[model samples]
Target: MNSPQLAIVLGTRPEIVKLAPIIRECRDRDVPHIVVHTGQHYSPQLTEVFFDELELPPPDHALGVGSATHGEQTGSMIAGIEEVLLEADPETVLVQGDTNTTLAATIAASKLDAELGHVEAGLRSDDRGMPEEVNRIICDHTADRLFAPTPAAAENLRAEGVPSDRISVTGNTVVDALQRHRGLAADRTAVLDDLGVEPGEYGLLTLHRAENVDDPDRFADLLTGVGRVAREYEMDVVYPAHPRARKKLEDLRVPNAVEVVEPLDYLEFLRLESDASVILTDSGGVQEEACVLGVPCVTLRENTERPETIAAGANRLGGVTPTGIFETAREMVGTDAEWENPFGDGDAAARILDAAAATDADGADDSAAATEAVQ
Candidate 1:
């Protein structure tokens, strides 16, 4: 007869951004919910700023599981999360995307009797080389409910032998977060003025992928290509430099054409995103957000799990090579603005929560029945 409690787990910036909507929804509904931060991204600038900007509650638990090798980090998270699961004993555990936190929490909660829900489930590049692909596949198998962001994702899950009953084609929750924050961003319009750039007159750049930023040649080529694009279009580029990319740019002596700026908080980033002419990045969440905001995106990766954005004409995959980057930028700049957003409208978070609550209630009823039968 009691309302079931929900536990939402997030670790990285993208997970925090995408999960904000569902957290807000839980607050509005007065659902008994606990938020656990894994501290996977330990920087104050990255984690604290996002929580403050999003007005998210301070996490109920911070695992303080800072950076490590992939295996070590995930193993540590599983240990930490198991402790949290035992202490919280929530009716459901919610995780977002294909991070170590998502996979570890999925495994932890699945091992327990609690219901597990995976947001952004069923995305696949079909290339097992990427650790994220492995994380996603493992989480999908472990989850009790799959909250897929698109029909394509749902179909993928079905093909992979996930029962249709456990899979629900809810739209992507990133759109909900984007729409909610874009309104706040409009009200606080000083970011553009502070950057001294007119709206829609600048290109946004973000590159932090290991492939692009870790290799010296690739890093140099990316910087050169980005600088070339800026010069060719006569557009100012505002790069909220990722810490790793910042070091690489300095080491490689990147051109002065690209302005390296400190990372913006979520609202500031959203405002900048709203006003940018185009976004060039390897970030998965940015790909979805750009599509939702109707901004043309040139993905810096060779491939993406969110292929619906490309199929819908909202984005194009541009590899890290100089020629590939330049060609894609030119193509996007020349493309028409009539592209459709394959990602859903701003209702995804609501839909996901609805399904979760229903699933939780049904689970509780079944458990009660089993107990009575035992008696």
Candidate 2:
């Protein structure tokens, strides 16, 4: 019924999870905001369930721009998001993480009158081979507001010559969302029981990145590596297969110790993450979640955007080889899980809103609005 003052654009499960706190903040503040889902991740299990689990309002707009080539997906989402921006005519448009949806929303909002804010800004893996890295760089350069999750991220923005005025170290919303929902996840989900796994006994594995799964040789080596870790540690691993990765599983000799399961909902996955002995993943969000959850993590990549996890001693880069994965898993499994969280306290959502509200619709400073916004 109200003309939305903010437009939150997202498209993947990680986006939904990371942005949930902001949506809740908006509701609590009575800030009229509309959610636009670009359908980059369209599966109901991955997408719709998050809205329900997070108690978020259904998306105001869903652009069914399903699977396509990188260019096609980004192009389609830009057109769809532009249409939503035109109609909603919000004062600010916010997008989270590095995805086609983020890039599209950034490009769309850049051309419009709305100020564009990028959540999880200035994360660089320094791997130009990854499409996500490209998207992150483009979105950061184009955004009016850069919400860096950590001081390191803020420094990266500064090094890139991003104006200090346009940047804010608002922490990572994943911490906010995780702190709020992990208790609910523990209480509401019996995923551990359903999977016949006990707390701190089973390993959690997730591999969806194109670099890891798209190559047959690399995928096979990763599975073999997990198998080595499982056998060495005497633990069974639950691999919640992403749709893209699942397709490549056919005819591949999956390790007997690694049980491939369908993708779990947010609550289920969170429960698993909270209780697992070690988490092996390529997802940046999972890296943050693992760090926040105090779970030892072994990244299945050579480099990561979330290097804070590594510097915190909560995570180790395992690369994509059997020897590397096994060694990292062995090293991480012995960790105490007491590493300090490098992300931030669970108030990022509030700070981000504060920053956004501090600026007027025309992008001018308004100290009174900032104070009122936090009040």
Candidate 3:
């Protein structure tokens, strides 16, 4: 088989969802590309199932580098991704978001004869204590092309002294995936009924960040705060527990008003986000989705990379304390969901691919130069 022109590297569920549109673009344009799953999220539910749901081709390579310490996990992913890069020898490698996989793939691709493009680049939470903050910083600095999702993100790249030529404000791909699939989710899934909640009457909750869920006290506090708000409003707060957070839930005291359920599939989750009155999450992707879906959002983090949501009045930062959560929920729950979608017009995939194809063309020219020099 001929070497692919592009290698799309992903590991977690969000990566699959965000990258699905780009992969589809490659297929539609008949661009030669291979997908490599680093298996940072090894669960079939989290990784493999998204391919089927998103109607994406199976990953050409699955590394199966499951959970471990940060060092151990990233180390395994770097080694595994290096092997894939060596074999495929793609002209460009694309990675998304700030996962261990993204950092690992960036490191591996930087060492090889490949141009690296980082989607959703130049986002800075400015909280280096967060593992994701560190991962994203490294990926942005090392990547050859930075696909900033907003002008603000592009400015961030500029502030970092990344040449403006290297950064493109391609918007966030989550908008593309949401716009494409939301109608399908509404029509195909009965997730609201299955969860025993009424549309526009329930609060959807998702907490998975290690800073939020790893500590039993913080985890319990977040749940308690969210649950109290749900009770105050006489609304049910549905928490779809991530695999990482489930273990913490087992040891904690869950509130009565918060119903903790197993993680839902992409369609189910999308449907939930659309129909819910408000969304409470620590996931950056969820913040973007809730904003686009016109559902008010209260981010559990003290700070967010997607400050666009806050500036647009579509979201609020609700810290981990119960009072803070309650106050923010009280402030946002009754507001009109009329905030304009700050992300884009649902065509980020095309812009990113356009930039990527240009990068691939430049790589060919550079390769040709090397060959001539050797001759």
The digit string of per-residue lDDT tens for model 3 on 12-43 reads 99999999999999999999999999888888
Which prediction has more favorable lDDT, 2 or 3? 2
TM-score of 3: 0.95
Residue lDDT tens for model 2, 1-375: 656989999999999999999999999999999999999998898899999999998999999899999999999999999998998899999999999999999999999999898989999999998999999999999988888888788789889998877877777899899889889999999899898999999999999988888999999999999999999989999999988899999969999999999999999999999999999998898999999899999999999999999999999999999999998888999689778888877888988888887654422242223222322
- Off-target runs (Cα >4 Å) in candidate 1 are 1-4, 360-375
How do these models rank on TM-score, best leading?
Answer: 2, 3, 1
Which residue pairs show collisions in model 2? none
Query: Model 1: how far is 231 from its true place, Å?
Result: 1.4
* Best of the candidates, lDDT: 2
All candidates' lDDT scores?
Answer: 0.84, 0.89, 0.88
RMSD of each: 6.0, 3.3, 6.0
What would the per-residue lDDT of candidate 1 be over residues 152-266, giving only the tens digit for each residue? 8877988999877777777787877887788899897588999888877899988887777888998888878888888888998889987767877777877676888987788
* TM-score of each prediction: 0.92, 0.95, 0.95
* TM-score pick, better of 1 and 3: 3
